[model samples]
Target: MTRVAVVQSCTGIDPAANADALTAALGRAADGGAAIAFTPEMTGLLDRDRARAAACIVGEDEDRVLATAREVAARHGLWVQIGSLALRAEDGARSVNRGFLIDGAGAIRARYDKLHLFDVDLPGGESWRESSSYLAGERAVVAETPAGRLGMTICYDLRFPDLYRALSDAGATILAVPAAFTVPTGEAHWHVLLRARAIEAGAWVIAAAQSGRHADGRTTYGRSLVVDPWGEVVLDMGEGEGVGFAEIDAARIDEVRARVPALRHRRPIPRVEIAA
Candidate 1:
């Protein structure tokens, strides 16, 4: 059994505080015998103001959060997957929502930049244009780990099943979606979307999420979860700052795929036109 842990918590403008909270969470996970741990999106900072984000930017080589997380992972001898950090982009005008995977020895294994942007108008008069402050990533990433191949993605990417399918086809048996999904969307679509992805790909889904309200007054849906290939939610923590853990049998992945085989039966979707 591969024991995995997820953090369901809040974030703020203070990067140091966030790191401290994460370290404590990691300790809890380690005590529970988790071999792998993941945190929520914007694990470092959560300022909605674009200028503040730019001002707080740290280069990939010298990022404080990354450095601290590496040390923590090394100390615990566990695989650590940070949800997302605001790293300087190529143009230096904005940052990329990047997720970093660190091996048990604390070496950086892989990184994935978030591909989708969250641009929406909420029912409560909240408007977010994440693209304004982030550059969309063009590539999908899947990395090999001791447990299995992990497909990495950020918040908004959860809405796109195509990306998840591509990762599944590329031999990904586990998918990680680190998100700070807004309250409205999270309450309505979070579980459905996560379970659907797990069922469709016949892979385990581990989603770490931001819960409660942030310093910028942005509310996030906080039910971080781990779902089995059969769409069974192994663990779920609704609305709080806490750690959730589950032991996943990697061998069960093959059993589910062999039993259902939905991935092999997918027919190519055809385009259609309608008269105006």
Candidate 2:
């Protein structure tokens, strides 16, 4: 069994302060004997104001939060997933919401940019145009680590099942879905969606989340979760800022798949001709 830690934090507008908070959380996870640590989306900073967020964003090489995470991973000898950092894009008009998978040696093993953008206008008059300031990624990423092969995704990607299916087909046993989900949608759909993904893919799903009200006055749902392949929630950090730990057993994936075999039984649907 590989032990993993998931961090739930209320990130503010300040990148430096966010890094400090994440570093401290990593320390706690390390003390708990976790082999890998996962952080929430926008781990560096969370600001709704596009201009202010752009001003605060920096290149990956200059991001203090990313640097701190690397250092912490190396110090603890733990694999770290820096869940999504908003970095200044090469185009200059927008930023990239990128996730990094780092080895215990502090070397970056894989990078996955967020493919889906949240562009919803909510019922409470809250509006988000994430695509306006963030470019969408074109590819999916799966990386090999000590614990298992992990498929990386962020935030809005959770709503897309095809992505998860593709990852599972590509040999990913675990899926990392780090999110900064809005409270309203999260309350209604978060748990069900995550559990559905795990059950459909026959994979372990770990979701570290952002919680509470942030500096930009945005509120997020705070249930960081670890769901087993059987659709059971092994761990749930409910409505608070803290760290949660869970064990990932590779055999559990096989056990679940052997019983159902849904993946192997999948067949393409035939197109039907209708009278016009």
Candidate 3:
């Protein structure tokens, strides 16, 4: 069983303060015998005020939060999966939700930009226009990690199963979904969607999420989870802010897939024709 840790945190507006919290979490994860640690979305900075967020949101090369994470990962000899960071886009006007997988030695193994943008007006008068401030990513990403071949996706991407299918078909053994989800939606679909994805892909699913209320006055549904290939909840850190650990049994993937063989059975669907 490969040990992994999930860091559930309530990020604030200050990037410096957020970095301090993350570093401390990494220390605890390492000390707890976790080989790799995963953190939620907006690990760097979570500010609804884009005007205020602009100052801290810089290019990936100059992102202080990413820099801090890399240094800490290397020092602790632990692999770290940053759920996603808000970074200034190439055009310099918009931003991108990007996640990174850092090796134990501090080398970046892969980067997955969030593909799905949340643009909706909910029933409770809650509204978000992510596409207005962020550009959508076009491609999917899968990379190597100490735990296994990791498939990467951000929060909203969890709602889209095609991305997960592509990742699993590409030989991903473990799926990483790092999210900062809203309270309402998280409560309604968090557990079910995660379990379904694990069952469909027949791969272990690990979601490290942001929990509690943030400095930006937004509350996230915090229930970081780990589901085995058989759709069993191995670990669920409910409504708290801290690091939780779980064991990913590599053999479980083989056992589940061998029985289901869903991936092998997948066939291309043809276009529909209408008869008048």
TM-scores for every candidate against the unseen true structure: 0.95, 0.97, 0.98
Q: Write the per-residue lDDT of candidate 2 for residues 90-111, one digit (tens) a residue.
A: 7776799999999999999999
Candidate 2 global lDDT: 0.94
Question: Candidate 2: deviation at residue 127, Å?
Answer: 0.8
True-vs-predicted CA distance for residue 36, candidate 3, Å? 0.7
As for lDDT, the candidate ahead, 1 or 2, is: 2
Q: Give the worst 10-residue stretch by lDDT in candidate 2.
A: 266-275
Q: Which candidate ranks first by lDDT, i.e. highest? A: 2
Local accuracy of candidate 1 as per-residue lDDT tens digits, 1-276 = 888889887998877888788888988888888999989998988888767666777878767788888988999998899999998986776789999999889899999999999998888798998888788999999998766899998988999999998999898999999999888898899999999999999999999999998887788889999999999998989998999888889988989999999988987778887869
TM-score of 2: 0.97
How far out, in Å, is residue 205 in model 1? 0.3
Alpha-carbon deviation at 125 in model 2, angstroms? 1.0
